[model samples]
Target: MRIVFIPVASPLHDEKAVQELIHQYKESVKDVDSFTHLITSEEDVQSVNIRQDDVALIGVLTGGTEHLILAIAMRVRATALLPHPTQNSLPASIEAQSRLSLSGYPSVIIKEWPPEASIRSYVKSWKVVRSLKNYVFGLLGQPSPWLVYSSGHDIEKELEERLGISFKFISLDEVYHEYGLIMDDEARELAVQITSRAVDVEVPMNEVIKSVKLYLAIRKILEREGIKAFTIRCFDIIKSLDTTACLPLALLNSEGFVAGCEGDVPALLSMVILKELTGKPGFMGNIAWVENNRFLLAHCTVPLDLPTKYKLRTHFESGRGVGISGIVEERTKVTLFRVDPLTQSMRVVKGKVISGFPQSNQHCRTQLWIESSDSIKLVTEPIGNHYVLVYGDYYEELKWVAEAMDLYLL
Candidate 1:
């Protein structure tokens, strides 16, 4: 990532003072490949090369910085401000932000001239999100029966216009019928490869193999459609073909493809956003229960790479099909988020995996206990029943995403 330091100083201002400030700015961002260009006059801007890839850290050192801003804004739509850390410059910086927003540009506001550690991290995530747009997300089948109000209603058009992420719905039967066309020997080999990660296999090995073949079939469908992320109406398969998509979902996520279970659109959206911000996988889970700072969260499956220990079990609800019973360790930081399509907002919570919890048949097989710093708020706050889990504390990243997409963050 490259940072272009555009220091704007009007003719009336002291050039030496601006030079001192620019020296401090360059010193702070020394780790990255940064270019420093002082803008003493509007003509000075013409000499600087403004690449589309570079992020401008515009330093408002003097009154008439708008000329420099106007010149840069035409070439680059994404910009961040490095305002002087005094009361006098803050209002000006805010006004600049408002002007940019009204003009339809994505902007970031760093309060201090030499930003803190958090600001640097935020800018990094923002750069990743800015370049990612117009990608396709596949929704396999519909939302699960219970999540009708929460996720079933398709809001793909709204999301595409807002975030530049498109959603394409895939017919369930179309993909299922394609499974039979796969070679039997190939299915067997794929099944063996999938079950290799299981420490204990409770269901019949043949059933697991069939489940693996189903996963392979889904993979082909996803590739054919150019879909990289998806959510499956997992329970429908169990009811129709007497199998589960849990293993397939897990394997897909592990391979860097985003897949949410129960065909949850919001959960899938949350997963994609997190994946874009962090380049990591996310797990969709239920808010099983809460106690003090610790809460029990569970899902039938997670990315195959996440569990500290792995086991195979029958799907909890139907008492049929494959489910994974895995353990995730304590004190692992994670980000929790759920996109509310109705409000076009994302509710996020940061917590640590406190320990693995014993599961009851009433809930999904795999379970984890999480501890939140603000546990009471996380528990009491009214959020979507389902949340997506990614292994990191990305508070700043989510904030930027919400702002950039005009989605409220709760």
Candidate 2:
């Protein structure tokens, strides 16, 4: 991503002062492709060609930043203000943004870094925005009846139109048909690979093989349709096919494809971004309970690689299909986030894994007790019932992404 440093300098300021300010700005933004100046009333704003998808860094050297900000925003849709070089720099930036807003021009503001140094966050976020062009997502079957926070067609279409990610619908019947048509040997091979890691297999051999069949079928569809990420109506699969998709979803995710449960579009979309940032898929789970700084997260299945412990089990409610009982390491860093379909907003928080829940039949089999730095938002401002949890601290990347997409981060 190239950056054009638009230094708003007035003739009243000494030329030496403006040069020193530009020097500091260049040192801070040391890695970008290019830096050009648009000195106030001296350089022709109309003559500058602001390229598409570029971020303009407002170098607040002197007064009269509005004209420069407006000129940059006119051609480049996104603009930013880097960390201030001096105390007065920030106020100048804010004043410039205010005037731009008054004139109906918008600029993204990055105030403080979580420890900054990762200036690449803005570049990475812009890359995600450009990379999503023509990206396809598969939504297999309808959302579960319990997913009250899920969206309908209008919201789905709106997301597709606004986010540039195409969503395609696939039916359960088609998946079932493919499951029945897979070669017997392929299912057996997948079953062997899956059962090799289990501490104890509670599922019957036949059902285990069927889960493998579903896995192969889903993979076939994803490869054929060019679907980068997918979510399924797992409950419907359990009811109609007499087998749960837990194992297959886990395998798909571990293989680098984003697989979400309950046909949750937002959860799957969050997973897509996580995969892009972390190079790994995330876990989607219900917020079972909350207490002070700690909250409980549990799910029937997760990507096989995430857990330090794994055991096969029956689906929590039906007790007739495959599920996973897995454990995450205590004190492991994690970030949980969810996209609210209605508002197109994302709620994100960083935390550490505190402990594992006691083995029980009541909740989904896999459980994690997470302790957040600030739990007030978890209690007071939940975006939805479920959120995607992935290992590592991606707070800056998420923040930059939210900025680039114009998504509200609550």
Candidate 3:
């Protein structure tokens, strides 16, 4: 990662003192790899270029340079990091950051010279946010009919503008066309492989084979269209083919592809962010039950690699096709989060797995009882129904990414 420092100062200040302070500031970061560009006047700010993957550090050398720094930030269209070493620098940084943030730009202020480790950590988070540019995610069919708040082209556009990712909408007909081309002989081998790993298989072999064929069809589409991740209107497939997409989504997510159910773009994007930020596949599920500090998340499909043991069962609601009843280890540290494009915010909460396996069959197949102090917010101040869960505490990283993306963190 490259760190470019742009130093700005006012001519009204003592020229010699300003130059000395600028020299000391440059010397402080010399041990680390960085480039210093001195902006003595307004003209110099116009020539600055902050490219992708580059951390733009704005050095506020004087109080009168707020407008100058704002101009540079607006020109680059990137987040700004203000470092205050001199007397007036801190005050100027506060003003500049306020203006930038009010205008929907991401900016942060550093009171003093930070340690190399801290700088590296922040830079790492910045790079993760930049890496998402131009990545493509496919949405198969429309969102499930009931997801009124979770479906729309405007949501996709908002995410694309903020995160630099693309969304591809694939028709159900295309998926069915590809599903028909898969030979039964080919799908049987994969079905056998998936069934062998399960602790129990309650569904029929033919159903498992049909589900495997859907997985293959989606895989073919992903490859052909250069899509890196995807989500499907899983319930719709059961009506057309008498088979569910639960098994296919599970297989895809386990293979490190960001696959989600119900064609929920926000949930899919949240999973993509989790996968990219923390090298782990997230389990996307519905918020089935919430009571005070305890809540339940249930879904038909979970990444096959997440659960220690899993069973094959028929789809819970329709009872027509394959579903997964995965057993996650108890007391596992987890993070639950959701991205809301309408509000331009992200809701994150930290929790632990109280029960990895479900005792009741009232909800979806794979269920988890999570304990979080903020779980009640899901009922009172809900962002949406679905939230993605991953097996670790990523609150800090998520916070940083949200700030860098100019998103309100809840």
Candidate 4:
């Protein structure tokens, strides 16, 4: 990644001193591949070429160049990183950043020379945000009947505007059509592969074959539609086809595709964001129980890659089709987050995996006991029933992404 530095200095300042300051600033971050160009006037701002992936660093050199800096920032239409050097640069950066924030453009001000690690983090965040533009997310069937607040045309518009992603809603009929196209021998072969990796297969061979065929169907749609991430109204399949989407969703996630259940668009969006930020699949689950500093998250499906060992079980609710009973490692650091489209906000909480229990029939198949101080917020200030969990401490990255997307972080 290239850092294209646009140095903004007022003509009132001594040119030689400004040049020296710019030289020092470049030397400080010389470890990075960066190029500097002076923006002395409005005409100079026009010469700056800030590409989509470039880290546009505004070298704030003097106090009177706020307008020039803002102009350059506006030209790129992305989050600007303003590193303030000595000689009135800090004041200028504050002014320009304030304007950018007030106008709803994201900008960050660095009062000191940032470490190389911080610079890389900033660039990663910037790239994640840029990667959202024009990306397509598929919604297989409408959101489940119970997700009233999480799905709608209004919510889609709000998401599209905030994240710059498009939503594609494919009917369940299409998925079923694709499922029917898979040959029995092909499905059986894939099912054997999946069952061979499992600690045990408690479900019937036909059910496992059905699940694998569903996975193949959805994979086909994802490839054909160029979908980056997707969610399914999975319960509909259980009712219509006497099968569940648990295994398919888990398989999709294991293949590095971001997939969610219940057609929870907000949860799906949260998973997509987490995947982009951390390059790990998120396990979307229901808030089964929450106490003061601990909680239980359960779901019928989990990313196959997340579990140390897993069993193929019947769907927890219907007890008819394939579900995953995954055992996650204890004491693993994890982050739980949810995006609320109605509020345009995100709630992130860090926790450690205490243990995983799959013996309960009352809850979903894969269950985890998590210890988090912020678990009470799940009751006091709820975003929704579903939260996406990934196995790592990605709180900082999530905060950066929320800020870049202008979503309120809780």
How would you order the candidates by lDDT, starting with the best? 3, 4, 2, 1
Worst 10 residues of 3 by lDDT: 114-123
lDDT of 2 by residue, 1-410 (tens): 35555666665676887787678666766446567754676366656545865677666676545566666677776677654545365666777677766776547656653214645677667667666665787889988888776757776786778777888899999999998898767788768767887878888777788888899999999999998788899988887889999989988898988899898888887888877866877998988888888888889988999888788888888887789888777889999988775786888889999886435679999989889866667668766677899998888789878877788988
Q: Highest TM-score: which candidate?
A: 4
How many residue pairs clash per model?
A: 0, 0, 0, 0
Model 4: ten consecutive residues of lowest lDDT: 27-36
Off by over 4 Å in 3: 1-44, 51-55, 59-71, 82-105, 111-121
**Per-residue lDDT for 107-164 in model 4, tens only?**
7875566434455565566667777775788999988889877778888898788668
Summarize candidate 1's per-residue lDDT along 1-410 as a digit string, tens digits: 35566776666777677778778767665334456577767677777777775667777776666656767755664677777764235666677778887888767777754675645665655554554464687888877788755664357667666556777889899777877777667778767766776777788877887778788889999999998888888888887777888888888998988888877777777887788778888878888888888777888888888887788888888877778887777788988888777777777788998777545777788888888865566567655677888788888778777765567888
Candidate 1 — which residues are off by over 4 angstroms?
1-5, 12-37, 41-56, 62-79, 84-108, 152-154, 373-381
Error of 3 at 382 (Å): 1.3
Best by lDDT: 3
Q: Is candidate 2 or 4 superior in lDDT?
A: 4
TM-score of every candidate:
0.83, 0.87, 0.84, 0.88
**Per-residue alpha-carbon lDDT of model 3 for 274-367, expressed as tens digits?**
8888889999999999887999999999999999999999999998899999999999999998989899899999999999996778889999
